[model samples]
Target: MMKFLSFLLLGFAFLLTGCSEDANVIEVEHPEKVTVAFFEALYNEKNIEKAASACSPALARIIRHYRSPQAVARHMFNMSYDKVEIKPDDSGVKVREQFKNKAIITVYFDGYYQENRIKDVKRLSLIQQDNKWFIDKILKDPF
Candidate 1:
């Protein structure tokens, strides 16, 4: 009976470890993916530090200055959502505009705040350093 109880506890511990929040983090292997992950972490997960992890050092410092996900989302990004769905614009290769170590990606945000629907588009510039993509800046909206 003692051996069976120990085995059961060990199995439960493994299960708990597998269910940790870290498991839900998105792995950004590409420029567009990083842009999407940035907004998702900020708007959906409401995690400022996690969102800043996808940014360049300069941009991350700016984001961190806000100190809260809501502040970053509202002031920096100029939008807020209780829940959001982000997708890269799939227009074409010409639209994506990826170069050797730089890329410009456009993403769409569909979200809601207090039952009010909101939709916005953002253009992001990214740079690759040490083979990892980081968000460099958010371009001004043209429209």
Candidate 2:
């Protein structure tokens, strides 16, 4: 009876805690959405901390190292995404790419910095940690 009670209490505790990403900020589930939101927070809202929150620990460190959010925002102001492709795995529609903890999201964009008319593609490395996806790295590819 004591064992059953302990198990029941443990289950209840898990239910109460849930799986919230962060208590202070909005929770974004998908990797693609998180990437878009990160850039939006950085470029549009000019919130470096908020942008950093959407990234992995390493990327967050880089963002925090910047002098000011406004400066980073200014540098990225011209960038805009054309599309995002989330790599699909054998899991199908129900749990696409569920088997893999890490994913690469391809972001196609136009108008980056001084080159307003140029088109470019960037691959964002994302890792699922604590049941939340965070951007870990950004890789630029030649057009």
Candidate 3:
């Protein structure tokens, strides 16, 4: 009788523990929207420092090596100097993705420059951290 009673108690304890577990409460965060927004802001002010703050925080190297906040801005500002010649056409970033502890973004701009037009061009990879994005490539061409 004692052996049977102990087995019953063990089963009851197991049941209780299983019932206490909260299995459907996992929370995941997506960082893509935040990154896209950062780029838009960068286009506006051309400030590398402000843009850096928008990245994932792991992009310190990228921000630090940009010559200076102003230099990076100059490039961005020049892209549209004559009338928004270079600008990103669109972005396809998604939500709730574990893409990488970091990420690489390929930027494509479309606009006009001195009667010259640019399209389907400009590629870059950005590393993300703590809500910041940093440039891994300033100018690169695969083709």
Candidate 4:
């Protein structure tokens, strides 16, 4: 009887662990993370609304106008990937510039498109409103 009770408790614990894993909401606590999450939602997860949540109202509207994640990725961002690894560029060449309520960050994308590898870099302008960072614009690539 004790063994059966222990097994049931273990099963319940496993169930709880699985439930927590299912709630995979991205965290956007910082500018770099927000940028990464935005691309991940758009490219890998293919979730347009989730991606747009990290953008300014104007930018979000522009993104939504594409109608689908694929359209947004292709026409709007000009990059599409089957799998992607996105990160902020930390090469010390150009450090992240943060002003009173605005910041500029550069992000790097290394991914595959149709089994071919591709890389791209983007400089993003961000603004803080109500203590939350929103992507205001995608600056022209400096590379």
Looking at model 2, the pairs that clash are: none
| Structural RMSD, model 3 | 15.7
lDDT by residue (tens digit), candidate 2, 66-113: 756755543433344233222222233433265467777665544344
Identify the superior model by lDDT, candidate 1 or candidate 4.
1
Best-to-worst order by lDDT is 1, 4, 2, 3
What TM-score, computed on C-alpha atoms, does each candidate reach? 0.80, 0.59, 0.42, 0.77
Tens-digit lDDT string for candidate 1 (1-143): 99999999999999999776564444576888899888888888888877888889899899899999999988977887999889998877853343878898999989899999999999999888887888999899947
Error of 2 at 40 (Å): 0.9
Whole-model lDDT, candidate 3?
0.48
State in Å the error of residue 97, model 1.
7.8
Q: How much does candidate 2 score in TM-score? A: 0.59
Residue 36, model 3: Cα distance from true site in angstroms: 4.2
Strongest candidate by TM-score = 1
- Minimum summed lDDT over a 10-residue window in model 2 is located at 81-90
Winner by lDDT: 1
Q: What local distance difference test score does each model get?
A: 0.85, 0.63, 0.48, 0.83
lDDT of 4 by residue, 69-132 (tens): 9999888668989999998977664323437677788888999999999999888998888777
Candidates 1 and 3 compared by TM-score, better number: 1
